[model samples]
Target: MNALGALAAFAAASSLFCGATAARHSYAEGDKVKLWANVVGPFSNPSVTYQYYERLPFCQPLDGLVHKPATLGELVDGNRLVLTPYDIAFQQNRERVTLCSKALTRREVQQFQAAIRDDFYFQMVLDDSLPMWGFVGKLEKVAPATPAEKETHRISLFTHMHFDIAYNLDRVIEVNVSTDSSRTVDISEDVTPNTEDGTIRAEFTYSVVWSPTDIPYAQRMEKYRRVQFLPQHLEIHWFSIINSCVTVLLLTGFLATILLRVLRNDFLRFSRDEDAMEDAEESGWKYCHGDVFRFPPNHNLFCALIGTGTQLFFLGIFIFLLSCVGAFAPYSRGSMYTALIVLYALTAGIAGYTAGSYYRQMGGTAWVRNTLLTCVVFCGPFFIAFCINNTIAIAYGSTAAFPFGTICIIAVIWALVTLPLTILGCIIGKNTRTDFKAPCRTTKYPREVPDLPWYRSALPQMLGAGFLPFSAIYIELYYIFASVWGHKIYTIYPILFIVFIILLIVTAFICVAMTYFQLAAEDHRWWWRSFFCGGSTGLFVYAYSIYFYFQRSDMSGLMQSCFFFGYVACVCLGFFIMLGTVGWRASLLFVRHIYKAIKCE
Candidate 1:
């Protein structure tokens, strides 16, 4: 043949040969050992939930948080995490994709190890080549409900995912709640491997491990009660806090009337009877008609803080309500947190405006403090938490999909939308202050500033009042904290409401008591005092977290460190918010009381 013709024929033949050859795979049987893994949740989702996670980038981060659990079909499926599956081991890479795999080798070992290390805190539980064998699994659960929803007050759940391998995952897995499954696991899943590392894709039967407890709702709640706080109870606290503030306000108003009218008429009134002053004996000074309830600190500043806190209270309520309504369902991904962040920003706007306006009216020289503190209260701690978590994710090779760009967007949202709204409110308040004048008068000289009475005189009492509400909700707070940090699966939104109730009660009562005590002691720096009394609860909650941390031996040092900062962030935030609330109420009360004292004299 001619040279060119020979070359062309050879090329064509080689092309045909290459096309006919079987694709190369490093995980072929007998080639190497296999790598083992399980799904990340306590219980596996339906095929659909699997599909959902497989599709979302944001949710991909969550997979590393949970572990595979069993189903109720154990009687039928036997002891297997992966049942009735084809190629269960899935691989995703930058190149060649295999839609199936039933066996394992050195290549799978390397790949599985990489993925597990990236997502899990624990080392691989098992690493061995498939013995060309298979297993089955079962699971069951009942959804929570009231009598009207379920006669037995139980939600039944059943699930199973099993796998075996001749060439890939294969087995029969079924989960059912009706079966006698006192021991049932709640979490597990299977991943699609990216073995080729070349944009290939695959998914197999999923597996999960759990504590395997299936019980009635009451029983579950009993367990939860041991760990969770009811948010409604928190609401009771909220109301109590509110009522306490109101009671103080009423006292101030009543005293303002008596001092301004009766006491002033007897002494300082422009048209007063001189004889009335001589006759006005201290014994005749009625608590209701005389300005006896006098001593309020920073009346203007306190009112401003309270108004902002009120706005935050409602904002938090709305956010929690949304969370309870399924805004943040596991299947729904991070929607709940996203919603929560936005709501927090919204609340910040109201708080800022209220505080700024009130501070402005109180002749505050520190405008920057007003805005900066407000901003920090709303954003700083969360930022610190995010930074710490992000640092860990960097080391682990996992990243939040939203990234810094998303964070910038959130900042812009707060700065542009919330900030402007706040500034506008401040302007409005400044303009309208004359219409509703505050009663706290600026004395020529600041009233006799005393030595720091924080320790010697009444620090213990102040601390106790601040933490009273926190004590009421510690149970629920524990569960909520676990849900967020322990990687434990639970519904804490309801308990959050209970916390709100309790906070209201505690805040109000504590504020009332603290105000009374401070007044009785003649400590009128009411602004900071109110904050000191109310914000102390957050500190108490933090103390409990410290206790929990010192006691928990299961957490790794890394987890412990991360959790410490995370919890402290939450505590600091709660502390400031409570402070703002207490300060506001105290300011309002003090002002009213001053008017009564002046009138009564």
Candidate 2:
């Protein structure tokens, strides 16, 4: 036989031998171990809820288990629940525990350990017919590891569990682990254990340790009532809320004063007295009544902003409603971002329709260009920001980056679904017979805007108008940043929705006041100022984002910073669009009403 044939035969034999060894390494058998149950937490002064572990695989069940729930009297001695500090072992109220499986192989135990360690948490779910595993927590590890062990590979959780919070022991359902001694455990397809030394034996044991605290139920439950269960500073949040309320109150007071006093007097004098009306028009905004509603420069962009803002407004509303109803509770992994993408895609029509209608009202001849720009204006910036962030994530090899296929899928959704719907909406809006009625006729010449003090200039008014709305939402913004960067859960959707509504109301009121002041100062170039007034809130939000990144969060690395800032920019841009639209609408209404009230003829 040739040497080549012999070498090929040898190689084939080696492959078979390796494959057989792997097949053997896949499954192993071991002795029976008990799964114990315990109540172990309420670890801090303000903590009330105790963690219930259904199965602690390491310790013998007879060591620390309680067969029955402790009575309220047993729980507290004088002012505190009978404490069990971690420094001392729990010795009382112990019982043996039954297992879901009477015994598991050494390999099976290792696989479960690997799953818990990698996933950061695990749970055991009870079923009458067949029991299963359930929820998990992402918390710091409690054990020490060898120097060679990587942080991610360390087994942090050993049969940790989740169960319903029950007042009585009987109300908590328990399931016995299956006592099948002959059961074999196969190495999971996903989890690969390091057992090269042939020492992959069932040697590790688990225990249930309780550390009790004296915190009452009311105080503990109050913490959970907030949107964030864990925050950097809860007291700071309270202060922020108070500050926001004060700002809102101040703005509301000023607006009320204007509406009740200044505007009222202007209306009365103009309506009842002809001489005062004629004199008022000589120098102030009354002179520009004929041109108040004239289509501003860059009408296309204005229309697009309005359209995109309309879409985002409703999209946010839908998200809040769905989240409040608990739609994202069961499967929250990546759900919020998924919902945002899908909802925004579906709401494309609103953007197109609004922009098209506004453009048409402005007597724009380039309908196609206007409609296309409406779609591109906001989305273009968002897509660019997304790409930059994703690229940074990919360079860092972070799992947070969207895969190429997911990116392609998102693109397809935008192109195939969103684009067509937007175009259809634009067509419908353009064809619709909506009125672009101006109370007064426009003159060939534009009104001369009077010189004003620095405080009354557009920039100052914009800043002031923006600051009040920002103050209204700066508290909620912290929670949102925590949720995004700190991996904290933001479950209080109802409160978030309320805050959103308040922000809108504040923006509108401030914009109206700013617009009224600008007009009263005899400045007819209020169109852009009105839009910019509320949109400037985004600048404040962006500034807060920077502060949050540096002060509140511990996140480091350039990629992380880039990703954070990129997304924040997009968020701020969206805010700018939404608040700007509110300002524009408010100013529009105010201008119309004031001009129409005066005798134009």
Candidate 3:
């Protein structure tokens, strides 16, 4: 062959040779193959790694089934098929095989198990619930196998689907499986019935060996083992539990201390004196003697803060509950959050109007500030999340998330749907008013809030308030953020959501107790103390995130997106919500204490 013609002839010959090699490698039904492997890279520091390995087929004996008993059945089937179901233990019927690796922590273990459960096995009749191209596989049973290294701790399970589907299904290699056990099998006999459509029902069952290869080794300890190599960053659920209990304990202590002192002074020292605290309260909380509701909080600010805060609390509660139930698990599209935020804002018009009117009734001014604060405090985080999502959009080179157009659409919806409704609510609330007649201790001027050591100041106490809530659930928050920004696939949003609720309750309780304690200490500066207690937990979350970032590895470019303005919005929202929580508690307590000390005429 000369030049061009020679090259063409050589290319045709090479193509034919490659095609033949591929056909030979194709796994045939009756053929026995040892393995499939990847000798190269899936890329450096891969999150989803590709691996190829040996495929070992295993099966269960067919002794219990009513069978045809053909010559084939009579000859070799009886030799090994003598496994009895009722009398004999199943441990022997099911065999074990080895796999490449194991998981280490609970998250890793969960991921490992789920990988197998969600994986399709042959003969599994995974129905129309999935698309035509859905993954389909079958594996009858699972069992632990011999470990390659005892210290390394590897274990494997035998999946019988391969044994049954191989065209040469007759010969049993230590064990045998039938088409019946394989889910992908298309046998006419529908012996196993799924209650729901095959596609709709989720099958989640798998077992795998879990071992931590790198341990307390110096370098490993500094790196991977620091977070302990979980499949997720940190699942917020577990950490929330520890934090909730601690918060409860601290709040209980504060309440008990205050209530005991109040009781002792009233019953013992004052000897049934109804006015035990009121006796010398003129210089204390009673100092706000004239017009305790001095600046009736902008008349519109009233219903706006209370109504909106209440709604936010309930919405937050539901979202967290859903999270705890795994609704927002890692595989779920993050778009759901955007959807939720949108829906919440649309529905919050009622709360907004209620608050606006209340503030108006309370003789408040600055209508613009009131309206703006309502939107900023309640709907602002979503704005930032939108931006972060946009950054992600840029990174992904797609506008699947809240694009600029979508954001404008959302803003319009909020304005048209929620804002008008809120204004209407304010108008309605303004048309009606209910008198709140509560007893209080009267005084001439505001009480000079106690001045003392720096430790007792509202600034320091606010810092303390933040600590407990953070302590109760910093770890849980870590896991949640990790799943989101760090791109860890998670499936336990519902459960973690419960932790969020518990965190809220615990934070609120702690704030109430701490606010009371500060009041008792003659620190009537409730505004700052209130914000400190509830808002401080976010600070802990921020601090912990930094610590975790240094420790985490193998990220999908999360570092760049994490420090952006979008994340700052998340931080700010967390702080403000906490601030609102503490402020609300302080306001309520301020009203209660003043009423209790008052001598109504």
Candidate 4:
């Protein structure tokens, strides 16, 4: 009861937080407009971000410092907003107004040069509602005058910014930033050692232009969706989805043929072959009926894995459905992540029930321990990786590091809400569970399994079983990776949902066929083997991530690499568990159905 109350409170709080965005305001003429600086990072690596003024020598606002409070999701997404010192009146044009004058030290000059060379971009908000982006500076290469001379480069920082604010009646609809190349100051020439007092002085200036537009404020975000290479991206996405659908059809047909023709013959022969069974002439899967339903080893861990997988399976479905329906706005900061965290908390009971019921069915005696294990099965490793990444982020002074308060809140939620509901579920599952009833009884003495060919072995079968499923989603993986590690916005949730279904169907069909072949080879250890066969797709995904990091992406530096691989490893781990459980459950049903059809003396 206490847990239920806590969960309700948390849900309400999360709902309010997620609903809170930049407040839209109706501005009158000559009203003071507020501007905010959000974050700055190298354009090449989107995940590596820092506070806007963290490494820059920018002037702070004089009339007391003010910061916009960030929500849980915003903090997690590495957004920190601080009011800038710029003064602008709504719908009032100003030209050549000096925003700040800063005396740059040698270090500050070097920082600006590095920012330009790395193509750093900064994000700012206008009227606390619209986001605008601009590059910090520019780097241009200079051709050598003589053929024997080496080429050099020049770095110039954008000193003047021109803001174009579009208005619709009393509301601001769009904000754009443009800079003139002629207004930039050459850092190399202005910051030479011959400068007086070894200090270079620079002034940042800006101009504002107000224009009226008929476009509605609601549709203002449409322009940001028009990304570069959009047509090519859509083409590849459609091709991949279509390719996956065809693969799923072929696999479904193949599995259907095997189930109808091959399984029918096996069932017919096994049901009418009493003489052959007595004479020890029976061969293949039917001969291993007695051992097929025998309990798998390490039943506790297996049950926990299955339960966690089931939880992830449902989580995936809900998230995709919500995204397809536009419940999570792609342009809204941290909306998707906030939804994920809240939903995962709410689904704790599902994991508990699944692990508990499956454990009870497997004749497990320690129900409490099983429930606890189920809770930690996925979160434990993820937490460890998160800690390591957070520590590294802190060391590098990146905004990606989670604040101490955020960590405490997460811990409290897990302990107070998620833990209690899971306990309740475990209690219910344990009390209401039924025994596992097998069609064929196991013999007192175990049967000796015959040797099989290399291709029929566990390792080989896992490799073969995982390849097709990986192929089904490998292309989609590229887009997902690009969205996460690059600057692309992924809004095609409907296609993602379709591809997700295709991947699952392909995984289930492939696992079922593999289990059938393993049983035909008289290997009754299909329990763990089935799980691994399905989970092996994650291995392929991680391998592809390695290739992408080196060959396909522009990501560099140690901090970025650690962040990429560490989080990707955790994702792959979850993927492995989820698909593994799917395969294991499908094989279990297939085995039971086949065994139930055969006659045993």
Candidate 5:
């Protein structure tokens, strides 16, 4: 009895080994597979590529019905599935694992019929949404297999598994899928179910036909873009741009009027006539000529903020221009992010020099402290936020987390490339003094600020003033949020760049206007307020981000929430710094010019 059991076990092991060997042999390299599709679209040329199944799967588990459990390939450490492109194509027809509706119930059949009527369809996801190529070659059916052909089994063809468009007429749509080869054949009718014996059943027919084209890869890529934003949506963006432009134009007219007439009269009288000058000086902005150029409190920190802001401003412009020129194409996943990091690193010199020069000008003796702070102020927050997001992603077992090696590389770039470059920038800025000097010296004693109304208060004015800049980009913001979180494509970067310029112009105009009003009210504390006023636009942006998270996005889970909010905060902080600096610089120039033209002792 023991001998018999041993012999049986040995036979079972032998059979398992042979089955594994046969499976491996069926999917060898250089084998061709026919592509098939259940439903085709108006554009039927499918984009086919040999992609590793482990990296990008054709389909994944969606909510609802359980699929036929068939594991064709092995997964390595739950991070990646160990699969070759050949193995995936080999298992297409042979592996009878359906993704949705494994055993179609009567209700499911009705639902499918309804979905088909509504023009529901499937799309291929290679890197992004790839368009399907149709077949147009001659038909060549396989003959009945002999013993030899049966033993050496051939691989089946693969195609996109997209659904058909809804046709209300008969609740069915005709689709023609194009392929490279001409072996066209109709699928077996038996594969589809017919209503019989009080049971309603249905199945899809996946067929392949041969079609060929002589288009280059680059040309073809334009048609086969993934997750494409519809061209019709451009109208909405144009409308937003037009509306924002109208608002900006009106604001510009108001500023133009103020500068050309009202301020011009004040400057003329204050500079030319003794009586008119005294009257003007006694009442408005002309009175504070001596104190307008007063150094702001905590001058070192103020200068550092200005320096960092300048760096960010230039960095943003450089990146937007690059994107507009297609340096980072929408199809190239993560290219924008990579470009941003590299550019930021290269521009560290700008930040360093600006901070160093300003700190020196402000009479800051601690160069080391100022330099270190300049480097860390923005980067420190970003680094901390990134670490937090990475930690959460790691805990959630998300692929979004950067590996240790990547983290090390980033750190090295910051230390070796970004820091040293910033130092170099600082040296240049220190050597290069500004041509426009302050007309009056800063007083030893600070001016006493008077009580102000609620409307004129810094915080209230900032909050209200921020909305215009935010409005200029709110429409674009929606698309950007969609692209970042929804995994959609944002190719309309030219519009974005244009809007960016509009935002900057509007911010500058508003800041100058607000500073003029503040200074006219005898508030020499315009230094910090000017910075915060324009910077407040980022606050509105953060508010919009909150709105997007709660109302617009479909993202769920604590990890995702944390990641979204954390990163947005960092972005807003950077934006705030950049915008504030612009406002401050504009106010400085305005104050300096006015003071220089005035009758100052």
Candidate 6:
């Protein structure tokens, strides 16, 4: 009860914090609106980003104002916003204001040319609400006038920016940036990089135009929600979902028919005829009942995996539900990540309880080790990946790197809150644990498993079991990958929720069938086999990720490659554990049910 109360309070506080932050964007008239320069990267690869002024010879704000401290969400999203020198009052228009004028050195000129040639773009924010994007410069190829004439390319920098701010009454609703082509300076003519000292000076300027609109503040973000590719994505998403549902339906029907006919016949034959029971040649699942209830090896690790998987399952459902209900703003930077981190910390008790109870049920005496393993099962690999990714980011001078303070904060949360709660739950679980209570008693001697066909091997069964689940979500995985590694913004949470359910159902059903086959083959070693069978879906997912990286995405560079694979490996590991637990649980219930119905005496 105390734990429940504490969880409720923490949730309430988080809700309040999110609500307060949402309203911070609203501003009164004549308020000093702050402009923030965010990140710059190659337009072709969205994952590769760096500080806006990292290599640019741009002027900084002379006021020396301290940068706004980033939120947890912001840090997770790799958004670092620094105040720009641009000064503009809310709802007040400014015309042709000079930002900076400086003579470019030869190296600086070459840098600008390189940026233009590489199609670099920068991002900025207004009042920390509206985001604006623009290319660094334009590259054009001059067409040959005659057949013998050679075509030449020209590069020009956009020196002037025109910002159009739309307002509804007093609150800013929309922001747009337009570059004036007429105000561009020819880079080849004005900026000569061949000279020892560049003679050309670069003048950067901007203008603001405020326009009132009837669009409500609540609906200001509608523009971003209207993605052009959304219709196509929806079509694919729905089709894949329907396909998965049909597969599940067929699988369930097949299993049900087999149980009703084959299993019923076997049970009736065994129960009604004493001759059949005495037949030494009788070979089927009934023969394996003696050794089926035998305790599995490495029960501690199995318990931990089940516990952590249970925790992740619940966490996924909660996060998906919240997202579907718009509890977290989709456009809010790092909001999803922030929620995930906080909720994962708060849910540590669930993991501990699950692992501890299962450990006790398995007749294990090492409660402390079991509890510790549960706590670190998912987080352990994730932490290592986070460290590697952060190190790569820091080396590349990318904004994706988490600051030391943020890392310390995360560590503090884990130590002070997560650890204690997990320990408490472990204590409760240990006290409340009941016996395993398998319907059948294990035989003193283990049954010798007969050699089966190559197709009935563990490896083949795992591969077959995982393929269906992977097929269910492969289509949606593309959109997720695009959103994470590409430039797309993912907001289709309802569909995602549906697909998640479908994946779980498919995994559960497939694993149940696989276990039945294994048992029917007179193999009593279904414990770890079921787990590997279910978790093999993660292997498929990782394989698909490899395909996506090489064929589907434009992501490149060593840093991005490392970051992608590192984090994805962690995600796949979690997926493996989560689904593996599901499979094991489903198989356990099935095994218990079939054995309980037979004459176990």
Best by lDDT: 4
- Writing each residue's lDDT as its tens digit, candidate 2 over 1-601 gives 4844743443343323222111111111221112222222211111111223322233333345433322221122101112111111122211222223224345545544543433422212211111223322222433437877645322322232212221111111222222122222233333344465533233221123222345432232233335453474555555666676677788789778756588777766656666655555365566667667778899988888899988988888777766665544421233455556767888899998999888889888888788788888888998898788777656644434565656677789889978998998888888894869989998888877767788998778878888888878888898888765653556667667777887888898889888887877777777888999979999999999999988887665566677678878988999999889888998899888888887775
What is each predicted model's overall lDDT from 0 to 1? 0.44, 0.60, 0.43, 0.84, 0.60, 0.83
Summed over model 2, clashes come to 10
Q: What digit string (tens of lDDT, one per residue) describes model 4 on residues 487-578?
A: 77787888889998888888888999999998888888899999999999999999999999999999998779988999999999999999
TM-score of 6: 0.93
Q: How would the candidate models be sorted by TM-score, starting from the highest?
A: 4, 6, 5, 2, 1, 3
The TM-score, computed over Cα atoms with residue i paired to residue i, of candidate 2 is 0.65
Candidate that scores best on TM-score: 4
lDDT of 3 by residue, 240-344 (tens): 576676667767786678754664453343333456645654433333434343433233443455666655665565455444433332212222444354446
Instruction: Give the per-residue lDDT of model 6 (tens digit) for 318-375.
Output: 6886676565654567777777888888788888898888788888998888888888
Question: What stretches of model 6 exceed 4 Å from their correct place?
Answer: 1-21, 24-29, 141-153, 188-199, 228-230
Q: Model 4, stretches more than 4 Å misplaced?
A: 1-16, 19-22, 147-149, 189-195, 228-231
Q: Give the better candidate number (5 or 6) by TM-score.
A: 6
**Residue-by-residue lDDT tens digits, candidate 1, 239-258:** 54455445445545655565
Better of 2 and 6 by lDDT: 6
Provide C-alpha RMSD values for all models, in order.
19.3, 17.5, 21.6, 3.1, 17.1, 2.8
When 1 and 2 are scored with TM-score, the better candidate is: 2
Q: How many pairs in model 5 have backbone atoms within 3 A of each other, for residues 3 or more apart or on separate chains, i.e. clashes? A: 32
Q: Residue 478 in candidate 1 has what lDDT?
A: 57
TM-score of structure candidate 3:
0.54
TM-score of each: 0.54, 0.65, 0.54, 0.94, 0.69, 0.93
Native-structure RMSD, model 4? 3.1
